[model samples]
Target: MMTRAYIFLNGVGEKEEFYKKLDFKNSSVYCADGGYRQCLKAGAIPKEVWGDFDSVSDSEFKDLEDSDIILRKFSKEKDSTDGELLIEYVSSKNYDEIYVLCGLGGRLDHELTNINLLFKYKNINIKTEKELLFSVDRKYTFINKKNKIISFVPFSDEVRNMNLKGFKYPLNDYLLKRGDSRCMSNIVCSDEATVDFNTGRLLCILND
Candidate 1:
């Protein structure tokens, strides 16, 4: 299945690297409100635009309409955030892989909500500004953080078979607690890292 890339403009930051990382040719791009400007700045035209006009100026909205991009405007009174709305749009399209840019480095609350959304859409490959968060079925996730540090946090009763390779504190068939930092600050000994859990939900954090 083709991967879909969504860009949300909370407040602009770097763009060149993000554009380079994304396979724009094979991916569908969605811009949320002010994100439209970011996409344009990156020389990408979004396939669809979503958000209330609160964040985007009138002229910008006109520019998007003039450019023929599909726009889905929502009301400010809605319960969902613009990022969440865009996510819903992508989910309905059945895209298995999703890369989100500009969702981080913004408001703290918004960033937290975006992170929580990872759990909401557990089946899709979701990449954010600072990390890649995705779940394998309802049990496991392969996370790549930004600084070569990996952390394993259990969200269920217990996570067994918790083998971790390429780390300072390597484990074999270990059990993790719901609230523990034993799995934190581990390093990757190899180029590729691996984590396996027997049962329960686990959040595997890996730093790149």
Candidate 2:
């Protein structure tokens, strides 16, 4: 079984209804500053909350004063974003997988930063109601997902020696370069599909 961690971010209004339906009972949950509001709205309590509190109002902070949840406060002039801090903290604890909720559909810069983190930490995945985003290093397999819209986005200059199996448009050891549209919008044709590469990383995005 995989040990999972759920990290909540501030930008969740776009898929608020979908996020509210998530069950955080089995996994460890953490909130980043204003993300605590989202966690509460989802009827889940966070194990810890880490941030500078810049995005959280004073009243909100005061309400958690008597709570047992661990609060790690930082300076407003910090080096990292609130989300980064929470991710690092959870990553250090050796969680098998980290699912970032409500990290997408926010400010463009922040959204890109969250996506970039996937390259650094392969165990991290940003999930929304309609899409699942993660990094694929050497190889990745999709199980029990037939006819799903899957896209392999090249993160490096070139994803070399790639082999796509069980796809609508399969590739045999092909070089997928950046800005190439060959790997986009492909559908999974088998219950177990796979993408293999010799070198470089790819962002594997799956749409439901």
Candidate 3:
């Protein structure tokens, strides 16, 4: 199945690169409020625009009104953040997989909240200018690329009975907990790697 790409105009760095790699024709595009500007800058067309319209400029809003895209506005004092609202919109459409762009590296609070908020959705990952990442709450297997550094962080206080295979520092029935630096940087040594944990969640990140 195909998935849509969600763009957030949070003014993250290296925006041009994100647009260069985006496939506009194959995926549905949704802009988070002011994200429409980034979408325009990236030379992408938007299918939908959503937000409180606070960050979106009057000129931009006027421009969008002249277009065929659907605009969904919310209150500034809404319970969920704009990012969360974007997710809610797409979720209602039954879009299972979404690639989020420019959701990192702007305001520290917004950056972190965007990342944490998406941890529960499967096949949904935030694609920052630097790297692509997703949260894992279960066993996961990855193809090993020699010398490629893959990082894993305990999403909770501790992860018990963690096992790793086909890695430089493979773990077996190990306990990986918070504040433990041992699992910070690990490289794949073989053709594949496996990670399984009994409890807690994992925030796995790979170098882009």
Candidate 4:
């Protein structure tokens, strides 16, 4: 039952450092279209490449095809974004953990959409940078921030039974609504912090 899933993004000007942090040997890597270029540059091959060939170059696609990487091409006239499509594909598999690299620092709209996808999938621990984000049914927690800022915002209805520990402004049985600023700008007071939401979708942001 080892953790075995990864998603790589190949947007414009992705940093090389992030790819170095990944353990490609054991994880099943997936790319979002042009992401295959970044995978090859990192000396890692993807198990599947999912997206419209819009951002992918012809030579790159040919190379991937030659390399035996499975390409799940979608039409340019599709509903879900390529990243979202990849997420759905992985959700069908029984992976314990999913790491997303080259996901941040891309288009602003894509970044926002990727963050929202966190709420759609549970059971699998999704991590980016050094932050781990996951939800247990209705509750979500962000951890592994050594000295970082963790902020929470309710994405659905008001969040209830909110509790915070190991933070500068600890909360006890607090209720957070859409317009509440009580959970903003909270710093990690310990090696790690925990944020639990009882009944709502929350966008838990962790900054290093």
Give stretches of model 4 more than 4 Å off: 12-14, 123-137, 140-147, 190-193
Candidate with the greatest lDDT versus the true structure: 2
Give the number of the best model, judged by TM-score: 2
- Over the stretch 1-208, how does candidate 4's per-residue lDDT look in tens digits? 5967878776543346756777888889898887777678877878999989898888877887787778888899989998888988787787877766666656889876776777787544445555554444555444565557777777766888888888889999888888888887788877666777677777765654
lDDT of 2 at 134: 93
lDDT of 4 at 140: 42
RMSD of 3: 1.9
Error of 2 at 26 (Å): 1.8
Per-candidate TM equals: 0.78, 0.94, 0.91, 0.83
**lDDT of candidates 1 onward, in order:** 0.69, 0.87, 0.77, 0.74
In candidate 1 the C-alpha lDDT for residue 8 amounts to: 51
What lDDT is reached at residue 194 by model 1?
69
**Candidate 4 positional error at 185, Å:** 3.3
Q: lDDT (0-100) at residue 161 of candidate 2?
A: 97
Kindly list the per-residue Cα lDDT of model 3 for residues 54-162, writing each as its tens digit: 8888988998888889988888998887777886667667665677777777689987887786675556687776677888767887874667788888878899999
Candidate scoring better on TM-score of 1 and 4 = 4
Winner by lDDT between candidate 4 and candidate 2: 2
Give a tens-digit lDDT track for model 1, residues 20-75.
Answer: 77677677888887778777776776898999978888888888889778889888
